[model samples]
Target: MELIEKHEEILERRAELLEQMESRREQLKIQRTKQVEKSEAARHRNITLLQDLQKIEDRLRGRQLPRPHLLALETRYWASVEQSVPAWEHFLLGKGPHPTDGPGQPPRRTKQTPSTAKGSGLPPRPKPRTAR
Candidate 1:
């Protein structure tokens, strides 16, 4: 009888220990899941920050120098303007041959006296009546 009671007690203790171990395992699993979720969140944040940094770097590089195509366009525009400046000056100042005139002909001058200025489409204003 004594031996049977001792054996039964031992079996019960073993069962209790097993139950505690199972509960501990469940707790450990929950903790591990939480840790994994935190790590994944941190990883996503890091990736986003890296992408933002890359965008900023790209913008900085763009600001440092204009694109080659835009630079070329600007250079071409200035060259065109410089080339035409002499012709424009000659035409405006009437100091040399005009671009539209024959090679050796001088620029033509137009008279611009106010009395002869009737090019405006609007009818001339009536002269203000004197305050009699």
Candidate 2:
């Protein structure tokens, strides 16, 4: 009889242990889900900040306002700039690299203004890279 009683007590203890373990496992799963949700929210916030920065840069370029740096502009154009205008032409306009060119080779680099103004301002044009 005593032996049977001891076995019954051991079985009850084992059942209690398994119940506790199952409860802990469920709690862990809930915590993991919360962590994943937090990470996704952070990523979304970062993307929104990047988009705002791009809009601010556009405003700084002065696309909405008239600018002295703007040469012949039809709808804020860059055709003259896009095509190969002579380096002297930029010099005549009082904006460009110093006239430096090899007799046979093209100029090594073109000149451009570095503007600090922002808020709808156009970005500075790229300087042409000529042969060394």
Per-residue CA lDDT of candidate 2, range 1-132, in tens? 999999999999999999999999999999999999999999999999999999999889856665656643653466645554586677667575545555776645433345433333666567899999
Stretches > 4 Å off in candidate 2: 62-66, 69-132
**Which lDDT tens digits does candidate 1 get at residues 96-125?**
665677757765655655654566444675
Alpha carbon lDDT of each predicted model: 0.85, 0.73
TM-score of each: 0.49, 0.43
Candidate closest to the true structure, highest TM-score: 1
Runs with alpha carbons beyond 4 Å of true place in candidate 1: 64-132
Q: How many pairs of residues in model 1 come into backbone collision?
A: 0
lDDT of 1 at 30: 100
Residue range with the least summed lDDT across 10 consecutive positions in model 1:
113-122
> Residue 83 CA error for candidate 1 (Å)?
32
Local error of candidate 2 at residue 99 (angstroms): 44
Candidate 1: residue pairs that collide = none
Give candidate 1's whole-model lDDT.
0.85
